[model samples]
Target: MSDAVEGGARRRGRDETEEERADRMWQELIQEVRVAQMGVQILFGFLLTVVFTEKYDDLTNTDQTIYLVTVVLGACATGALIGPVSLHRIVSGRRVKPQAVRLASRLTLLGLALLLATTTASLLLILRVATHNGFVPYLVAGVVGWYLLCWLVLPLWTRYRHTSE
Candidate 1:
């Protein structure tokens, strides 16, 4: 940390005002949220229609329960992902952009977790119904590993590898 960094002239190689940094970060966060929000909302919408399908009645009790949990997770994810917009709207002129960004980032992380659970549960339910075999769980677990590698591990590795002090 240098005086130049603290003086708000430069941070992590970007030279900008505090307000400009906040605005840029806010825009970046919004773009990321839009990507995740669309995904979670569409998944939630599809989950909502599952119970109305004629084939839904054929699901076993266990599968029905899984579907119920998945739908709930999807709903939770949708709410968490959309929460930032409402938060920003309510606090728009409060001069709290920094705090708002932190809170919104947390909400996005929580939403991603919920989305992961929803996706895993939905896959479990679907594979169970489609295969009706003991191997379905193992298959789902492998796919979950893939999701973790793609979604979490790669990003972390990149960050760790490229970050400068």
Candidate 2:
């Protein structure tokens, strides 16, 4: 029989240590979070300003409710997207980069879901108010389908197609 270290065990390709993997994953996670953070921040800022606009008073009760829901969803998305930064700050120098990256990834995913809801609600409210047509819901549904295709379906497809067990 050959030696355990040299023979039967499968050899890793690059022999990338855990620390190196964590470092690379953290960098990629941070870059992804940055893109999400910018978008959520801008959308949240715009949502906040809407209530102070002159047209705010003219909104019907249903539209106002939709606006409120949209704003709240946006706020939650903002919090979730920003969570990774705070997490990193608190966990810095703890040698738990892998755990941190996993947690941050979860938060980012939650933020994206909230963002999807916020965008859908905002679109529904705006289109209803603008068009006053029976087809508003249909239009909103179409847009939501598009968002799903872009945000969830494609990622999942790529993951399943390319990833190995």
Candidate 3:
């Protein structure tokens, strides 16, 4: 809130201009997106092949529905994760880096959330098909809890504990 201006441009703790900050943030976001994008793309690719497998026909109706939903979620996550690259390509040299960065960040977050849902659904379908046991939901819940702890809770806690603003 107390950022000061230098050479007519407001400076943050890093003393960088708005353009510099946007560039730095854009690089970091792209790196993060690359990692997530690769994983999601691979997952989505595999999900696409599921229907061609012989085992797919053996799945119960509910399992088939789950599989369908998982594949759709995975596709959506892939699109969202890749959206920043497309956005950057289309908006390059437009002097809208800051706005683009904000939109890309939001897309990345949405992609991550969708990825979680897709993975959870896939796991549920796989376990149900593989085990056909009663404790599958409990097992899936535990794994989901682990994912939430690792993906969401710890990051939030760290941010809350260490962030000054």
TM-score of each model, in listed order: 0.90, 0.90, 0.91
Report the lDDT tens digits of candidate 1 across residue range 70-116: 99999999999999999999999999998999999999999999999
Instruction: Give Cα distance to truth, residue 2, candidate 2, Å.
Output: 26
Measured on C-alpha atoms, candidate 1 has an lDDT of: 0.91
How do the residues 1-165 of candidate 3 rate in per-residue lDDT, one tens digit apiece? 368888999765776799999999999999999999988988899999999999999888999999999999999999999999999999999999999999999999999999999889989988998899999999999999999999999999998997766
Q: List the residue pairs that clash in candidate 1.
A: none
Using lDDT as the yardstick, the better of models 1 and 2 is 1
Give Cα distance to truth, residue 13, candidate 1, Å.
Answer: 1.3
The number of the candidate with the highest TM-score is 3
Candidate 2 has its poorest 10 consecutive residues by lDDT at: 1-10
Instruction: List runs of model 3 lying over 4 Å from the truth.
Output: 1-12
Return the candidate ranking by TM-score, descending: 3, 1, 2
Please tell me which predicted candidate would have the highest lDDT against the true structure.
3
Q: Write one digit per residue (lDDT tens) for candidate 2, span 62-149.
A: 9999999999999999999999999999999998998998998999999999989988998898899899899999999999999999
Task: State how far residue 69 of model 3 sits from its true place (Å).
Answer: 0.4
lDDT (Cα atoms) of all candidates against the true structure: 0.91, 0.90, 0.94
Answer with 2 or 3, whichever has the higher lDDT: 3
